[model samples]
Target: MSRARRLTASTTAYILIPILAAVSPLLVLPAITANHGASAWASVAIGQSIGTALATVVELGWGLNGPQRVARTSEKASLRWLTLSLQTKVIALIPASAVAAVAAAFLAPSDSLTSSLVACAMTASALTATWFFLGKGTPWLILATDGLPRLVCLALSAIFLVMGAPLMTYPVLGLLLPSALAPCLALYIAAKRAPLGTKLWWRARAVISALKLQSTALFARAASAVYIALPITLVSIASPSSVAAFAAGERLMRMGLAAVAVVPNAMQAWVGAPADRQSKWSRAKRAMAANAALGFISATIFGLAAPWAVTWVFSGVVTLDPISVWLFALAIFTICTSRGTGGIGLVALTRVRAIAVSAAAGACVGIPAILLGSAWGGVPGAVAGEILAELTVLSVQVVAIRRRLAAS
Candidate 1:
């Protein structure tokens, strides 16, 4: 196949995997909301948020740097690194799961089972093989190892929910099962690919060293969590109704951004490919252009459709304020831009510190903004705060790219 055709196929696969995964929840959502109203949705949202936030903790910086490293390394080296990362992540996952459980309990104490299971399921998402597949430029592996399992489980969740199964079954089937399996499958595939490196997997003390080595990416992801992953959790604390509405809007935003995510999903490896400085810089520019355009188009569509989309999707279990909808829409644009200019650019160039500092600056601005905004104006205010943080992230990244990639 031609290179352009191959990239198009890869990007399509990446886009469809997440969109299908995100949409699968809708099967249970309307039923859950129709039967119970927004409370269940609130807990589910909190669980997803906390789970996603702590997923970064469990991921231990691999999410930020893994694909780029995998792109530029040999199969044996990639397999060794994968094994070592899995070792460290397993250790991290234990505590991260505990934290997610505790956080879920605290946030949605009213719905302990739902919150805890969903949170744990989401937490388990750290083990996804998608990044490994992405780096290796094998979208088919992603579909097999990560996407299909999750889709099967989520589809089952919808059926089970209708069959009057236990509520906790949703996360168990939809999330946790695939979360546990993907890495193991990836490991088997990696071992098969690099049979000679089968014995090079890391053990106890190496896990510790990997944790220390991961601290830089850890800080960056944590900083980003303030704006990206924690908003629904925050709103759940402040207002039960608000979390549902905000989460609904945010969920749609995520689904839309999945399409946007295709750019980085495909181009990260391309941008980070073994190449001369100019060639890498040129690829990065093209990726950034594509990313920004997609973001803009997505933001506009989301801004217009969200107010009504939430009602239809959730069966009126919750509804967002127009201001909140627009804020989320604006954030979609900024986040897409940042991922291109900052996420793709910085990681490709190995500027982890720049990414960290930019995220920290965003968190510094976002935390207070979310707190105060929620206090003053409610959900819309919080959404506005998130948008500000997104802008801060985009600005810093743009500046960094100009200095780094431009010079390159």
Candidate 2:
């Protein structure tokens, strides 16, 4: 294929794969609740949340270290580090799966018979990690490793649901099975393309020394967590129901934002490739302005349609009041604008510390607002808190980006 066609295919695959993979799981929630009851469903959600949290920590660790390794070593050496990390993670997944199986058998309701299901879920997580590693070296590997699982899971879940299986079983089958298989499949493809070769291990002493020298990168990773993950965590704790509500709003918002992000994502890469600071600043401003316009237009649409959308999507499961709906719609707008600007600025300038600072500020504002809102206003309070936090974070990002551009 021509380079342009190849890039187009890759982008299309990335966009479509996740949507297909996510659809079955998203639609299956009502069935799961009908079969397992709310409390049981809550348990499963909590378990998944915990698993996701652990995975996030590991990802942060890897991100903090991975780029530093790339900076310190040749491209070939960096590829080796990535390959080794993928292998170690894949090997570790087996034991993790076993442990999750045992825990599900004991912790999940015995009547649910979730051990096999949980095992599959854990395996899938491991597979995803492997696929991600494969994608790092060969970007096209992303289509095979990343996109295939979604296709597989969508198929499996459809089959299971058609057979009148318990709703609880679908989560395990959908999440775990694909996750487990995607990596194995990717590895198989990878092996055929290029066999694994041994490389000298960077000793722990050297690795640790390298990490210490790149402390700013480490801090950036932590800041990223605060920026991206904190809102979801806070929502889960403050108003569990609101988490789902917010998630729905955010999902739709993200789809809209993705359309806006294409230009900015491309511009950042172009800017980063050159040493021309003036060109980078000009591109950044244009991206920010474009994002702002997109946000306003999208937010207006969301505000108008949120009530009907939420009611239809969550029909007979969760009901939303007007205030809750409004808050969620507002959040969708603020988060997209803030995150887009911040992401573009950070990438263009390579200002890791600024990214961290803005993210930290956002987390600081958002978490407390969630806590206080829940305590005082119930669901509405929770929604209000999220809006406040997001706005604060966005403000910080705007100021930081401006200062960075000025300095540049």
Candidate 3:
């Protein structure tokens, strides 16, 4: 297939995975709010929030570093690498699952065991052929194995919501079903097609070493998760109403970010291709510019429509103020412009520490911002902090990329 076709297909699949997956929350959350009220909706949202954070820990940099490994590896080594990576994630999965169970115990009192299991499943979903597919430049495969199951589960969630199933059932169908299905399907596909030679125990040892190598990339990935997941956790602590309002706005913003993520998803594959340094640098610069343009357009359109969208999506159960909605738009634009181009470029270039440091700096600015903002102005303040945090990360990513280019 042509490079352009692959990029477009991959980007579309990548975009669809999240958007389709989001249908669960978009449909279920509001349904719960309309049926049971904000407290019930908050219960599901809290479970999901905690689950998402644990899921990030389970991924352990595979999503970011796995693509780079795939990009640089020979075809013969690809399956072996995939197996090895899967082993490493599985090892991490054990402890992470334990942690999730404990977290669910404290955080999700309504249905702790089920919620924890859901969280563990979502976290384990990261251990699949996704990175291998992205690395092999067959990102469309991700749509089939990863995206399809979630879409199927989304339909189930919608049906359950319409039937007025119990509140916990919404999360069970929405979060647990998809999280369990997607990764299992991806791993099955990989195992049927390509078996690695590494023994289980040996693979475990090698995974330790691999973890050391990928530590910086892992750090970067974890830091990125903070801004995305932390606010939900924080808002839950603040108030049930705040959780509903913030989650409503945050989910919409995430959908927009997913749309523009096609740029970076393509950039990673494009930049990872074997090429001269100068040419790669040129492509990176162009990709960044293109991403920025897309971000601007996405931000403008989404910002304009957000007020109406928020009302409709939440069924008028919860409505964010204008400032919160616009700040969400700004956050969407910031992520769209920076994440796909600048952020992925750093990973492709193996500037893992640079990316990690930059993301850490943003978190340092963001966590406090979120706490203070939520305390002061609730949803709007939290979003204001989000805007500043993303902008901070973006600024650092640009400077780091520039310095890396000049030095090279």
lDDT of each: 0.81, 0.54, 0.71
| RMSD (Å) of each candidate, 1 decimal | 2.1, 5.3, 3.0
Q: Which ten residues in a row have the lowest lDDT in candidate 2?
A: 130-139
lDDT ranking from best to worst?
A: 1, 3, 2
Total backbone collisions, model 2: 4
- Scored by Cα lDDT, where does model 3 land? 0.71
Please give, for residues 79-126, the per-residue lDDT of candidate 1 as tens digits: 878888888888888988989988898888467878898999898898
Query: Of models 2 and 3, which has the larger TM-score?
Result: 3
- TM-score of predicted model 2? 0.72
Residue-wise C-alpha lDDT for candidate 2, range 1-408, written one tens digit per residue: 899887786566545543444354455555554554545454454444334433433333344334323333444555455555455555445555555455444444333345345433633363353323322333345546655655566567646765677655566666766665665665455444443563435455655554454466535544544434344445556666555555444444444454444443333333343447667657766777776766777677777776776555444454567777667667767865765576555655666667667666767776688777865776678778767877887887778777876775
How do all models score by TM-score?
Answer: 0.94, 0.72, 0.89
Off by over 4 Å in 1: 1-12, 405-408
lDDT of 2: 0.54
Better of 2 and 3 by lDDT: 3
